[model samples]
Target: MDTNTLMRTLDGTLTCTTLYGHKYRSAITGQDRMPMALEGLTRGKSLWIDSLVHFTCPLTPQQETQHLSRTPVPGSVCLHTPEETVTLHERGADVSFSEHDVPEDSFLSYRPRLLMAVTNITITANEWQHTEEWQLDLEEI
Candidate 1:
């Protein structure tokens, strides 16, 4: 797996726009297209998306102290703002296959290869309030 440090800074409440794509093929038919959707998040939203979407919010001050002393698991990070929690986990293997090589037997059987490079992120109101932009770095740790 490729290793790189990522930095994300959240100075204030921010919104992010994302895009998605799909494909289909048949002997008599061809591929199709679907429109993308707009997913919303606040200062403290954390999420993971595969076929479906999974979200996690930040722990409360008490919960933070209890759960997040050093490193955090996937569920422990919480988003404290008014926005919905959202996370995106990209499977590089699933999306890496060639269109022609995809099996024709099952439409739903294809599971995209995803790489969990950065698994967890925790955001604080103070961090968002003081910073203008959020940054994340992935370094050898």
Candidate 2:
């Protein structure tokens, strides 16, 4: 099956779970929800969906490193590092992470150092299936 082509067809809004224990709604394009294309399909009669999901959040260095390290989710993988990207593949899904790449000391000094992060998730399901990505953000309020 053409994973890239199928990914382009599957697109929609997806729910994101955060490591801090919160859920938010984000806008997804055809390329973002590509995983949906595999809905109700099997390996013998199913196709692979290649979709990507992006997320942005404001967080501190301490929060980003500590909270994320202790997170207890198996689906979401940490692409820890400033301006770094990581790829994840699981449950017929492909995931990626992107960050602004900031230094710890610099991040701490920056007022309201809001970290902007993006996650590119790709997955394939036998049936129309939906998955969530959780991120934990810490604040010094």
Candidate 3:
């Protein structure tokens, strides 16, 4: 277990834990005024709150391949992080996020993925316990 507390209930009873991931949900509201127009479509529109995820973890080469396969090539991927689970579409559509970058030891921003139907598979290869570890810098996708 990661032992990092991600979320808690209002009463401080429920808690969410994770090893190396964080979730952030942001909402942007837009309102346009048109006195001449009688249509209700242009008055104000509410948008779906988008999630910005920053995920970092270490895995073996085989595990890396599995994650790549899990990600949708042309579509969105539903992310199940330690904070929360949400169905998200990949914003950048880049498939090489986990290939080169490594995250430094810093503060992880936590805010808030996936449906209950599909379970996420996570494979972590810790450097202290495994012979090989592949560090990744997963962005919003």
Q: Which residue runs does candidate 1 get wrong by more than 4 Å? A: 1-52, 65-78, 83-141
**Local distance difference test scores for all models:** 0.26, 0.31, 0.32
TM-score of 3: 0.20
Point to the candidate with the largest lDDT: 3
Candidate 1 on 28-139: residue-level lDDT in tens? 1112232112145332333332322222323332221222112232332323333443222223212111222222221111222122233222332344334322232211
Residue 71's lDDT within candidate 1 is 26
Cα deviation at 104, candidate 2, in Å, is 4.4
Cα lDDT tens digits, model 3, 52-103, are 4444334333222223322232333433334444343343432333332222
All models, RMSD in angstroms: 23.6, 18.1, 20.4
Q: After superposing candidate 2, which stretches have Cα over 4 Å from the reference?
A: 1-51, 64-76, 83-141
**Global CA lDDT computed for model 3:** 0.32
* Model 2 local distance difference test score: 0.31
| TM-score for each predicted model, relative to the true structure | 0.15, 0.19, 0.20
Quote the positional error of residue 26 for candidate 1 in Å. Answer: 21
